[model samples]
Target chain A: MKLSIDRQIYSDACISKVVYWLSAQYAIERTLDGTIETLSISRNDGHPFDETELRSQCLRLLNDYKLRQTIDDETRDIRTILYAKAFADDENLTVE
Target chain B: MKYYLLPFKFTRIGDHEVFVNEVGDMLHAPIGTAEQIVNRTIEDPELYKSLVANFFISEIRIPALLDVYAERLAEKKRFLDDYTALHIFVLTLRCNQNCIYCQASSRDEHCAASSMSRENMRLAVQHMFKSRSQYLTMEFQGGEPSLEHDLFLYGIELAEEINQTEHRHLTYVLCTNSINLTDEVMATCKQYNVLISTSLDGPSWLHNQNRGKQDSYEKVVKGITKAREILGADRVSALMTASELSLNYPIEIVDEYHKLGFTSIFLRALNPYGKATDNADWEAYTNRFIEFYKQAFEHIIELNKQGHVMIEEYAAIILRKLLTPWCTGFVDLQSPAGIVNSVLIYNYDGYMYASDESRMLAEENDFTFQIGKLSESYENLVYSPKVKEWSKVWNNEAIAGCSDCALQAYCGADPVRNHSTQGDLYGFRPTSLFCKKNKAIIEYIISCVIDRYDELMPIFRNWIR
Candidate 1:
């Protein structure tokens, strides 16, 4: 199955994360065009796979990873402070 | 209204969005509710109140209970406070039965060379006492531990003798095939109050097929019954590994346990180690096992409804993580990759290994996880440079793929597994079998709780207890 995903719509990192997951079942190849990225996927061992199902899974995973990226972007600083507070032993430490 | 978004992630589960926070607090809300939280457009006052109350969203710069939350998080990870509590002693690699999926590579029963020496056993027990843990579990494992009667007895007797003066709470467990539960073994168990952990795959035919012995099931059942009679039924427990053949008979397997009057079953998966590495396709096997587990778990729930006290132990472990503020003592599901943290292995070869699987990898001549020799001092063994290297990738919150996962709170890190399976200490979660199996099961459990909320709560409550 070949998918031409819009680069603007989904970040490359998000697509890569999804492809990494599906790589166990599918041999995925990615190529970038000017504004579009194409993913060429085939069964890993020449076994049977449902093309429609794979497409749905890839799209769903892409959306999920995008959400994760957003969360990572939004909470980066606060998460660091939380960890520092949880593990740091210095009583004089301050997070500003 | 201004809202401060606490760290959380949401996934669609059967028409509902399940939100899980950093501390594993979960709430299932209607679809698009996740969007509402991100967009700050939550219209329902009660839903917004729940989000704030559960640490999903905060109204202030930090929640008023930030210190309390931090304390609770530290308490959940209390396993790291103790040096090590579970000490496994691999008595020998000699065995009587050739199991189809034996993770421990076993030699023939008469292979005296594979057995742990008396000197090694004494040194290993002495080394176990060096840990400052108030409680200790000295677990005896083997190709068939019962075959090495003298070594098992020696190890236990040494621990018991030490505990007399040391006064640490000590418990002994014998992991055996149960085929060789002779009277001598039973007598020792009775004397020491040793708990018997045995293996029973399924019905007679299935068990025999897996064991490669026609009379294997009969011997095991007879041995289990005898041990139960001697040590009391509560002291004997059985765990089953779901092989390819066993996948086809999930109901029969649970029914078999019920017939044997066992109250709980641990549905374990096959690890890629020793003889079990011959498994051709793990992706297909993983999918099959997930299906098998769901079916078997439902059957267990049905059994509970039918007035039987049946529990699925794996689900119980997950429930403890999901429904309670406490963390489970199950090493496999721990953050820091449980190896050398919660449990350590004193191998038959006079070496201290990171985990049970660490020694199995050694049987194949791979020594990535060998901590040190048994003769080494406790300080040198634990604080060695090799262990220092492992510490970097052992925490799930610090690892790739896992760090971003919403189920991160419920899942754990497995550096040994990553080193063995993926050839890296830091695993890639997208292609990780450990991640796949856990996420599927945990998500399915959450979905079940949402889909059958009122009907299944009582059943789930019973299982977790």
Candidate 2:
């Protein structure tokens, strides 16, 4: 099964995570051409592949990860501050 | 109209999208709620207020209550501050009863060279004090620790002698099969106020079948009765393991615990070690255990409704995680993966292991988790290179599949389990039984909260209380 994901819609990190999870059952090969990333996935057990099911699953995961990435990007500084304030010796963690 | 999104994860549970915040507080909303939150289109005033109040969003660039949020996050992980509190002392590997699925890899009753030496016990006690945790739990585990009664007493007495100056609050626990709680063991246990944690796998037929002895259940009941008379009823607790046969009778197991006067039962699953490694299919076993857990949990709830008063311990742990901001002391279900952070094992083989299962792994001569010898410095053993390698994969926040999991806050990472089962410390989460079981059970508990709120909350609140 070949999945061509547009980099504009999903970051490489998001797509990579989806592939990493599927890697347990499938041997996935990745190639990036400009803004398009393709995942050539094959079953590890040599069973017949369901391209539609696989594609839908990947799309769902990509969407979820993209939203998660947005949250991470928006909250990165606050999360760092949160940890620093929680654990670090210095208590003042006001962002200037 | 406009608000900044805080870090949270969402997943579809039945018809609703359940959003869990950074600290594990959950809120159920409509299907497109997360999309609305992210796209700045939340229309419901109540939800908007809830999102802000629950630390899921901020009206300002940084919420004024960020300090409170940080403190809650800190409290959720405060177990790290306590360092290693639960120190397991493996007294011996000589068990009288031969269990069908013995995770401890017990040997014959006459097995020599398989017990902790007195010098090693003394050193282990000294090592326990080295931990700065104000409260120390010295747990004696075995192939039936009662088999080595003298060693057990010596260990407790040695801890007492040293604790005179150390001044730490000490708790002693004896993990024994109730079949052999002799008068001597009972007396020592009484003097130290040691809590007796014994194994009881269900009714007589089921329990004996699991234990591989026809008369085992009769002896166990007799021993339990004896222990309760000597020690208080509250001090004697029993845990049941779901063997292959026991899976056929979840209600029977729960009823057996209730019948024996146990208010709570930890419905434990078989670990992948010792004789339990003989399980033909773990995926099938895990699937069955999930169903078994749900069925038994439903039965427990019904029992509670009947005024029987029973708590399913696994649910209580997950409930405490879900409903409260406090972290539980369950080593298996902790992030930063409990190994040395919350527990350390002093094996009878004169070596220090990362956990109880680590020592069990050593029985098969796989010492991957063996930290060092009892003779080694606490600093050297705890901070050894092996432990350093383990720390790399111990945090679920950093692991691949777990990093993006909607249920990550309620789940934990287990590098030792990963290593033992998957041949690596970083396991494949897609095929992880640990991940599957925890996610299913936690999600089921959440479903109960969503669908049967009024019916189950009273029972749940009492369990956590």
Candidate 3:
């Protein structure tokens, strides 16, 4: 099965996470050309494949991870400050 | 209006999107609520305030109460400050009953060679005091700890003698099968105020079948009765391990515990260790155990509704994580993983292991988890090179699949279980039965809270209380 994901809509990190999860049951190969990333997936045990289900799962995971990426990007600094304030002895963190 | 996003993770449960923060506070919103929150389009006044109040968002760039948020986050991980409180002493590997699935790899009662030597016992006691924890729990386990009565008694006496100068609040627990809870054992327990934690699988036929002994149930029941009479009912508690056969009888198992007058039941599943490693299909068993847990939990809820108070201990631990700001002492459900952070095992083989399951792995000649021998320094044993390797995979916040998981705060990391089941310390979460079982059950509990909040919250509140 070949999945062509638009890079503008989904990210490499998001698509990579989906592939990592499916790596247990499937052998997935990825290649990027221009803005489109193609995922070539095959079953690990040579069993029958569910193309529609697999595609839908990839899309859903991609959406979820993209949202997670947004959250991480927004909160990374604050999270660092939270941990420093919580554990660091010097408590040198300051938020503007 | 406009608000800045705080750190939170979300997953779909039932028809609602459940959002959990770093401190494990859960907020159930509509399906598109997360996208709305991220896009800064939340219009519901109540939902917006809830998101702000619950630490999911901030109206300002930095909330005024960030210190409070930091404190709550620290409080959830306060178990790290306590060091290793629960120290397990594997007194002997000799057991009376022949269990079909013995996780401890217990030998027959006649196997005195498997017992801990007196020199090792004294050294283990000395090592226990080396921990700086103000509170220490000295738990004795064995094929049957009562088989080594003299060693058990000596361990407690030595702890008490040292505690006079050490000034630590000490608790002693005896993990036994209760078949051989003799008068002498009861006297020793009474003298030391030691708590009895015994096993009762279920009813007679089921318990006897799982135990591989015909009269096992009767003897255990009689032992429980005697222990309660001599050592107060509150001091005697029981735990039930869900065997392959026991999974078919969840309601029967819960009812049996209630019938035996137990206030709480820890419906634990079989780990991949010792004789239990013989299980043919762990993935199927994990799925079945999740179903069994739900069935038994529903039955427990029904019992509580009938004005009978019964607590499912596993749910209570998860509930404490979700509902309270403080962390639980449960070793299996912690971030740094429980092995050495919360527990340590002084095995009968004169070597220190990371956890009880670590010692069980040692019985199978897999000493990947062995810390060091009893003769070594406490620092050397705890901070060994093997422990350093384990520490790499111990934190769930850093693991691959678990790092981004919405349920990471409610779940834990187990490098030992991963190594045992998957042949590596850094386990693949997609195929991990431990991961599957915990996620399914934690999601089921959250679904219950969403679907039947009013009906189950009071009962859950009482259980956590």
Candidate 4:
């Protein structure tokens, strides 16, 4: 169920593209049946709230979810993109 | 060994540089050494290459040496073979809002019928069509073009009719406040394909501070939203006039544009002339605008990695010319004097100025470059000695730093702006307010590209190739 990135070149400032890919990978990992533990990560503990209860107290998208939650073991496009951004100043992107 | 005297064409690249053939795409020339004759002469390699390229592409040796990069060399040699006027007539002197640094002063409430006569309009349009140039563009500008709605309508109709009948490629553009764009006006613009440009000095608080009859920012945003819905975002654009207040918080301007969904920004520096000449505060603001421009361009490029496609006009202009073969048609960038020679101005009274910023120099009936009246034909105005003077400066203006600077390749010594600030056409601006700001901005820009180059390589390659 992992994404195939062999033919696809990775690394860009494409945040939306990366996010969507992450979402898809998360879904695919959960649907794979063996990765239930990875998909269960959350920033906020589930709790009930009243109108006065600040919305910030409730959880939203989990940022620290395991990589296996999105991509299969073989796919590294998202990782490549992140690494590229992190190490942006060091490399000459043009193959020349 | 250097034979050619004045008009030096080639610059030395490290020890025998190469270029691609004529008429090909701006295809990257694969670097390779030419099989030269086993040389008996001893000389510098870079200088030798420069000389060889010149003589190779010279008129005397057309067939053999003029094989690669030759036609392109010729094209560059004759950059402005066609001189056409992208005439923008400021149709009205009347504007509703009072902006603090109003270059076209709102002081002239005595509206003077504030509109071009039907007769003058007819003459201007007719003169436009009669030109033998490849492309003709007519842009309508004003305190607010929409303020003179009937005159604008009249002028647009004339432009459309002439283009249809006379059969010339025409680009019709308008700069307005967007306050007066009614559905009728929008419909006419849509039908005729008029590119609409508006002004937004900054965000709500700052914009209202600078320009307000009513809440100017909301009004401008309303105008942009309404017009963009009608004319489409691609055809609708905005410009900013920087003031001291917005200088420190330049990101606010960029963020404001982003909030409004504009994909690009001119980050226009405030002019130091016109009613604004007294505003010494604007110099500080201009510097701030340049600083913000560098930061915003970097931020936008970073965001581009996150999937946003944004370009700053200043960066975009340099990048377009440096990386691509197709020209941006910016007036100042071309080699053969690109002022009144490339674009001219016809004011509302059929009075002409050689450059747009000419009348902005002094106050109370004192202006510099009222070169001719619009009643004169295009041929007459273009060939005038005033224009000849500007064209001569096309090589290197009488400016101080620009004429001698190494980076003149990437900059424009605007004599018109110089003439506006100082008493001379080649104003003492290298030391003045404008030059300091540009030097800082240009150096900062070069650093940014050179710094985070790894992140840029992918994007740069895609754009260049």
What residue pairs are clashing in model 3?
none
Which pairs in model 4 have colliding backbones?
A13-B305, A13-B306, A14-B305, A14-B306, A14-B307, A15-B306, A15-B307, A25-A70, A26-A70, B21-B69
Tens digits of per-residue lDDT, candidate 2, B62-177, equal 88988889889999999999999999999999999999999999999898888999999998999999999998999999898999999999999999999899999999999989
Better candidate by DockQ, 2 or 4:
2
Model 1 chain B lDDT-worst window of ten: B66-75
What's the best-to-worst order under DockQ? 3, 2, 1, 4
What is the Cα-based TM-score of model 4? 0.69
Who wins the DockQ comparison?
3
Q: What is the i-RMS of every prediction?
A: 1.9, 1.1, 0.7, 25.9
What digit string (tens of lDDT, one per residue) describes model 3 on residues A1-96? 999999999988888899999999999999999999999999999898889999998888898899999999999988888888887777566565
Query: lDDT for each of the candidates?
Result: 0.88, 0.92, 0.92, 0.56
Error of 3 at A39 (Å): 0.6
Taking all chains together, the TM-score of candidate 3 against the true structure is: 0.98
Residue-by-residue lDDT tens digits, candidate 1, B346-386:
99999999999999999999999999998888889988999
What are the per-residue Cα lDDT tens digits for candidate 3 across B44-119?
8899889999999998888899999998998999999899999999999999989988999999899759999999
Better of 1 and 3 by DockQ: 3
lDDT by residue (B238-323, candidate 4, tens digit) is 87777766666667787787778887777777776555667766556666677766776667676667776555676666655545
DockQ pick, better of 1 and 4: 1
Model 2: colliding residue pairs: none
Q: Candidates 1 and 3: which is better by lDDT?
A: 3
| Candidate 4: residue B147 Cα off by (Å) | 1.2
Could you list the chain B TM-scores for each candidate?
Answer: 0.98, 0.99, 0.99, 0.81
